[model samples]
Target: MTVTPDIVLVLCVLLVVIILFIIDRVRVDVVGIIVMVGLPLLGLVTPQQAVSGLSSNAVVSIIAVIIIGAGLDRTGVMNRLARLILRFAGKRESRITAMVSGTVAVISGFMQNIGAAALFMPAARRIASQTGIPVAHILLPMAYCAIIGGTLTLVGSSPLILLNDLLVVQGKSYEHFGMFSMTPIGIMLIIAALIYFYLLGKKILPGCKQIRERGPLSPLLDKTYHEVGKIYEMVIPENGFTKKSLGQLRIRANYACTVLAAYNHVTHKRIVAPLSEDELSPGDCLAVVGPPMFVEKLARDFGWIYKDELKVFADDLAPANAGIMEGIVTPRSALIGKRVGDFQFRRKYGVSPLAIFMGHEITVSDLSVQTVSEGNALLLHGKWSAFHRLKDQNDLVFTEPIRGEEIREDKATAALTCLAISLFMILVLNIQLSIALFFGALCMVLSGVLSIDEAYLSVDWMTVFLLAGLIPLGLAFENTGAAKLIADSLMHMLGVPSPIVLLASIALLTSFFTLFTSNVGATVLLVPLSMNLALSCGCDPRAAAMTVALAASNTFVLPTHQVNALIMRPAGLRPIDYLKAGAGMTIIFLIVLVAGMRIFF
Candidate 1:
């Protein structure tokens, strides 16, 4: 194949994309947008072809899958799954690892792997706290399984979903893969990962002695605030205490105690950071944080029953549900140049201040009237839901990882029904994958499983645009003969190798490439070339394309994959930890992948 000017231009663009991705300074999405516009300007692809990726089936399917996952999450499906896993797992560390990691792998077979990993993170931490197991042992296996789980279905991951679309673009002879076309391979891989972790995990995985103590309140806070960060539960006296607002009682002003959460027995509702004017009724339970002596004194004076353990609000106040976060006052914050109480910090934001760290001084007393300034770091205590809402605002720049959302248990059945219908459409009706998935997402919005706004927020636009923008680049590679040229050069370099050797080479190359760039990027760049290489060697081009997509998920040797990065800091994992554990996983994945392709396809 002759390399034309267009091929040179495409190669140049491909090289720039690789370098920009490696440097990691520019946002990956921005790199995508640059390609989207740059290609049309350079005359390699027509303007229409450049914009066509946005309307591609792969992009639409990803958006729909994300929305459906969000609807499930909003309605408490994942939470219920977590509870069931814990119930069956018991206190056995090995059982907990297998159960949790296996479940996440199955969940990830349909939705984005990162989302599945993230949804299970708090649950993993909770398990560690309860079982005295270091989180590192659980997280590495879970992350690896989540990545490999993408091979379970066509829509399980972006690379797999894009495979059929890329094949369709390759020409009409290549047919699309069914939803479960890759199921056998995915199951084998997941089982291999589970068994690997079960036998060798304790020896290979990193150890964090402080992981158990690093619950929601965190060991850092316990060391920094000492008694002030100690949490206690209090019950209002049934007959002696009258219905009085918190402000009237001056709980913070007099006793320096902050009510972090309140549970109303009458309404059966839980409120976090209740306003000062919110009345405290008899027999209500309060989750408070303060100095031990002061809390004890306040409890004695009010004839309240106080317990050191958070038994009543234990689940609700667990690290997974609620926790303390540090928020720095931004220069643009409305709280700047005013006292903390001026905005009714607790009432408006649903968060109560625990301490203020300004410069080198830390103050925990009289926080309500404390003057806020730019760069002042305020330690706030509240539910994770409140922090999730505040994360979008510019008032405070949260320094900690914020996760978890409030669940709508009432809509769980509706969400499950939508998912079931979507599956039925795909399996029974033989409808288009994009149309069927989007139909389910629409049903979710209509059924109140998720609001329209929530559905929109659920999508990771970065992943969508990255896949969409790169589609045309793949098209250009084929159009300009760039892919065929590279294929010829590779074949010439190997001097007409056998089909199996060629396949292994292709898989290994794709796996290595994915470690640096996004898996989506690796898939788009390699599929066309691999298909061309396969055709030249008289091998099945579809099998070669499948190898590219599957191999892209074999990114275990590094923490570049989104799932690995998400669990790294929380699990206290280092690069060496990944290297030691992932080395074995990567090898196992390749062996299973090559053998499965030869056997199944």
Candidate 2:
């Protein structure tokens, strides 16, 4: 049969999702909302049905889980966990590779994989810096692990939620997957990942072996003898304080300074906890700890030069036109594919690249020397006017990029508590899952885990609005007989009478679609087709729907398919790194999923 108005409308919606995914003109959530509401308005579905998708327990559960993940992140729990991992990682490449992959997998199973990667990227970078391991060696494995972990349960990702909803609507009753159902498969993937890393992962990852050599510990660490107070570095001028003893100069009494370390330029030897009565020589660099005002005054009065290289006293600068600006690198920005060193950013903008807070960790060195990637955050330090000017440049990507301060201890705690409540609500309390999530979100505010403002920030309102908007279109696909028509066409193509073949066909198509589009969008497009195919083949539609849902979550081939791609740059990964590690795992999971469905369904 020819395509109907309803079918045409559905195609148009799919086109929009694809276009947005390719060009990234708007947030994915915004696109989702447009398809959802616009389809119903075009007489595709009723208003009530359109709005009902927002109430899906699966959506609520996923959102609540994000809040919980955020809380765990804020309390320094994830960082603490990462630090522990690094301690055990030692210098062995094999051991470090395995632990990093295992950690990402475990965390991704419980929380959002994207969030898990974001939390660990900085820690991973720090560990790489300390241990002399190539960051590219660890990052791709971490991203793949998160993707694998998400496959373990229905609540692990958005695609799973869409799958669960599609199955429920298909009239087949299936248990919501356990929190760890996919763990067995996930573990197998981890083993495979370890093997890949040991063999090819180390060799193909970009960046010099010299980059893996351990560097000296941060200068600040070596300079500070005490941790309780602030430390400042001031250079003693030849005439200002030459040949004066600490007591003679009354440096402590005059400037409220406590000497932490004294560096002799001639000898290059650092004296930690220098003696109070020690004579200050010309050109001596002293590390002093005290209040900001006192430190600044001491520098000004003593004619001491200020050093920015030492973070110990870097924060004590005279606030030289300093302010924070947040921006996201657009796909089209000059930084899209350049390395940090390629740009010589410091010399160009007079701004030092501080810490990049992205879905991955782009370090100061990377920003200074390596090529830049899209969606990466560049934390700039310079005069406020310079920052404002740089921000206004066209080739730069600047939008609602999240600030570092947003991810704090309280928000992290709130996110964790919300997860706990969501777990109780989903597995134990047996209350309506959506209500449970809403309550959990409420607790984030009430219990001081997150302020009202912060709680609002934590919510991905675009996703919420998009899901709410898309739900009606999905319903319309079912109600308008479009689903049945598509199913019949697919069944005729398969030309096999077996339900198993039809199920596999549906799944394969969904997985293939997911490689290029949003997993949620893939599910919305194919769920109706799968249901129709199931009915035509005289099988339970829920079984077929579940297969497609599971397949949609299996995005291991391309970094662009999920949030995993965003981590590639910081990890210093090459394209082959993903293909080598992800290709094999994708095949394994696809096989396992088909076999599992045949037995379980």
Candidate 3:
């Protein structure tokens, strides 16, 4: 009858979490928040520990990661990269499937799998759209590929990396995994996944009734076009745009309008999503997008081509409206043969081209010499007003309204630059992961690829809250002896006199626990028990410890595992699908793990 106060608190928290997860009524973030704040209120952890997740370095890095991802996507960096890799995929469906999985795995092997997925998922979707390949066939494989990739290096997966550090802290340094020690097994799993997906998964990938044609971005871009900003074709007379570098103009800074592109007869140059260094010139015809007020002020200040408020069209000229519009540059149009830089398009026309499809390829690096091709497609970006104005002109072809056209060549450069610097710090300088990401995000914002406000908004608050709220519960479990209790119960029930069984049991249990919680959390709770079990069973504690670390990644089923969840919905897969697809991979991984142990130990 004399239950410890700690037990009551721990048990109460567990019961509450299970109930909340089952009901699924309250949001997951809310559930985490309750556990975070409730534990301390019930006298389990200190108030500091309860709110610790909010201040954790991991939380900040995660936020930075999301912002970094947004910068990459918004700037078309990922798109450009995806296009390059996908080009080699070939036309064969099987080849495409194999190539996509292989590329994602290689990228994921070096970076966080989630970030790698974010970079390539769109390309997979785009490939599906362009080639008539089923998205369902590729999305799930993409997720699995990334998961498998993480097993390759020391830092590939957090749990694996963190497990070593945790062991060192516990004074079990002798029994640790080296940086590339995981390569053998990790490669085995990755190869197995690739082969399986190509031979079996690709062939059987469902028609997925859930796949929306063109994937999620097209429709999102469609809806967001009219929902975000006003696009205007504003003229920039001598004083307004001439002689100031777009960076100096700080149009986005001072005027809040992006100079999508520009052309001027004065310079015979055109600017396409010109970087900050590209300057403006007199008589520049600029295309810009901004708030209605900024657009109007800009026009009044410059006296460029602008809509007369009284003489409007079908859609309102109010700045509140936003959408994607396209226009063709005609031979008669003054913009013809102009260097993009001459007009400060953003400063004049008030719109930018998302893509410039032409018969001849214009290397992006050759932007300086690139002229406006006479018969090319200019995927213009800006307000509905800009499109309307472009339409009335004698020179260009205007296409139907489109959405999601905010790609920037300059921003893409910024993303690449940021990623490059971060990678250097991480791989060359050996900087901590969180610090590397934080610094990279700062560089992204400062470089003008990602603005501060955009970075803040880019964060997925739900995931943040969930991370912040649930992290402290790990402390509660340890403090309350729940970890010990579980270890003892397992030892008595399944911990036979044999070391091999003990090792297998520990590894299996750790993998099972990761299905629901994070591998990091699972590792933290299981490390103590696993280490104790190893010693008591007379097992090589190092072998047993590493087994647990490897098992943490065996989080095969359950969308609850974020890695599995990454492409879950987009892949049009349900929980049952994950169980079916992942089970094979999990079994393959564990089998290799055991074999590797026997062979290496």
Candidate 4:
């Protein structure tokens, strides 16, 4: 098989994209845009096909799914589910690990994995703190569970959606797997992960001594108060700032305090990360953090009650309740390149930036002056419920546990019902998945589960655009014989004797490679090639495609994955830590993948 010039150019672009992703020098979406624009210019794919993925039903469905996830988040349904699951974890560290692993996995199948993990992280931390489980032991397993949980349904993961879409593009829509088609194998993989982590995998985990974490963010408390800053809270009287927006008050500038969350004395509810659009009502108790003197002065001037200890800031703690936690800034963090005071951290994110962690240096007390940079972790304080505001944010990930009732069952029921209707349409009515998802998103808004603006904000435009951009590369591969070339390369590397062996081999390869690059990128690059491999080998394309899709989520081995990175700083992880536990888990999962394929496929 001759490799055409088009194939060579496509392969070169693919290599460049992979390298850029691994190096962390450029953003993933930017890298994808390069491929989207480059492929057509290089004449690898026609201009029409290059932009086709942007309007594809697959991309549209994913956008709808993201909005639905947001509705679940705003409604607090997922959080309630997480808290309920946490009840079964028990006091034993091993039981806690098993339950957390399985719980997040199961819930993740229904919601976005990141959102599921976000709600559960606080619970997991609280469990670890109370039960004496090592934070390291719980965090990695939780992250892994989130990834595998998405495998249970086609809607559960991006790779699954992309694979099905690819099948449609290839005129194999009839053979596309159903919503629950991946459930059997997904359950098997999760069971294997939990069992391994519960028994044999426990030995590889760092002990409480090594992690030195009594609470997820406890180790950072000293730096928070003495180094970063201390926690503070203020109450807003109906007459003081009534009906005023956070933007109008200029409280952060006026009193030098970042407003974290507002507890309504009348409503008995705490609004976390209240948006600027939100008006300050009478009886609103705002949690703020600033210098002791400044906080006191602000309290006096506004005729508001100020609790320097942050007790009243906590929703559960009541008129006198408050608390503190840690939040890590990522590469593209909105909080970066600005001092905690200047940016009005608490006003913006609904939490005070108490301190910043830069490499080996920890700055706590003087955080207001120091500019935050990428990779810096900010320690914050406020109500546990207020922490939820931070969860919906994209730039930073919080480490502190959010205690008590997570999901608001009343509102959540509406979102869940909408999701059920969408799933019913896809599985029972055989409606186009994209159409069902779109209708579900609409229902969420109409039911008041989320406002239209909230729905728009909830979508991860980066993921949507990334999918749109990189998907055309798959078309290029198929068109230029690049897919066949890749298939031939793999066939030569591992001779195709039994189709099962070929399937397992492809799955194994995808699993290993996903540890290095974004799972979505890996999936987009390889799934088309896997389909071609199946056709060339006279094997089942559906089975081959499903294997590759599931395998793309095998992102347990490294912190390169977003879920892993989110937990790493909080867990105090090292590279070898991932290797010690992940290797065993990976090997066990490979066995399960092979067995599941042989039995189910």
Choose the strongest candidate by TM-score: 3
Model 3 over residues 394-483: C-alpha lDDT tens digits? 567765543344446666776888978887887789887678888998998999987798888877676677667766776777677765
Candidate 4 residue-wise lDDT, 187-226, digit = tens: 9999888888777755778655523222213454654545
| Candidate 1 per-residue C-alpha lDDT over 1-601 given as tens digits, one digit per residue, 9 for 90 to 100 | 7768888898899888766655657766677688889988998889998888787766676677668877876776765565566678766788999988898899899766765676677567666754568888888899999999888999888889889878843465598889899899999999999989988987778856634434346665556556464789999978998899877988887887888888888997878888887888999999888888999999999999998766567656766667888888998998899988887768777888888888878777688778999999888888777787777788999876785676787898998899888878865786776788899999999999888999998777776676667667766776777665765576578655677787787888788767644567668878887787778777888988999999888988655566775566668766567878988999999898988998988
Residue ranges of candidate 2 with Cα displaced over 4 Å: 25-29, 48-63, 90-101, 104-147, 150-419, 460-473, 497-504, 510-549, 555-588, 595-601
If ranked by TM-score, best first, what sequence of candidates would result?
3, 1, 4, 2
Report the C-alpha displacement of residue 51, candidate 3, in angstroms: 2.8
Model 3 misplacement above 4 A: 1-26, 91-98, 121-140, 162-177, 195-207, 210-402, 495-500, 515-532, 535-538, 559-588
RMSD of each: 9.4, 15.0, 14.5, 14.0
Task: Return the TM-score for candidate 3, rounded to 2 decimals.
Answer: 0.63
**C-alpha-based local distance difference test score of model 1:** 0.79
Ranking 3 against 4 by lDDT, winner? 4
Q: What is the lDDT of residue 353 in candidate 2?
A: 44
Tell me how far the alpha carbon of residue 536 in candidate 2 is from the true structure, in angstroms, after superposition.
11
Q: Compute the lDDT of residue 352 as modeled in candidate 1.
A: 82
User: Which runs of model 1 end up more than 4 angstroms from their true locations?
Assistant: 86-100, 107-147, 150-188, 192-229, 232-314, 323-406, 492-503, 509-588, 595-601
lDDT of each: 0.79, 0.59, 0.65, 0.69
